[model samples]
Target: MTAVVRHVMVRGRVQGVGYRAWVDHEARAKNLEGWVRNLRDGSVEAVFAGAEDVVTAMITACRRGPSLARVDAVQEEAGNPDALNLRRAGERFSVLPTV
Candidate 1:
């Protein structure tokens, strides 16, 4: 399997709506490695690293988020695993503090 990483920014009513937690659950369920966090601008940002297909699926899931999230737009770009910013040494996934 080809390993890949992606950085995604989710917009539209994403904050205070369990988006981060939802992402955390979804990513872990897919056995992905990365982190999600709230941005100061009210968007939610995330990095997903794993098999290309699994990471792609995770991004599709983000477009729908939790039932409560508006999810107006999802911007994506290639990501580097070296920039993951994981919370701990061996964490598989994490919900990071807001930036």
Candidate 2:
């Protein structure tokens, strides 16, 4: 099955609250290939590329981030994952430094 790829921008109490870490865990667990990072605009942006069901699950999880996060919105767009190697996502899904 072709996977769904989207650029997700999450806003509201998303930073400095382990949201990025939770995303990494959730993505890996769902076997989704993507990269996540903190944006300067106080929102978290990530790319999720995976089976439709898995991608949707990840998006749902993003809606209720880690306990420290109070997610207010989740914005998704058709796009790519910001990884150096898009095909090799099984090794490690990185949690990039703040950008």
Tell me the TM-score of each prediction against the true structure. 0.95, 0.85
Q: Which ten residues in a row have the lowest lDDT in candidate 2?
A: 80-89
Model 1 Cα lDDT, one tens digit per residue, 33-90:
9999999999999999999999999999999999989999999999987867665667
| Residue pairs with backbone atoms closer than 3 Å in model 2 (clashes) | none
Estimate, for each residue in 1-99, the C-alpha lDDT of model 2 and write its tens digit.
667787789999999899998999988888777788898999998888888888888988899999999999998878754443543445556677678
Local error of candidate 2 at residue 99 (angstroms): 1.4
Instruction: Give the TM-score (vs. native) of candidate 2.
Output: 0.85
- Note the Cα lDDT for every prediction shown: 0.92, 0.83
- The residue-level lDDT of candidate 2 at 63 comes to 94
Best by lDDT: 1
Per TM-score, the best of the predicted structures is: 1
Cα displacement (angstroms), candidate 2, residue 61, comes to: 0.8
Model 2 global lDDT (CA atoms, 0 to 1): 0.83
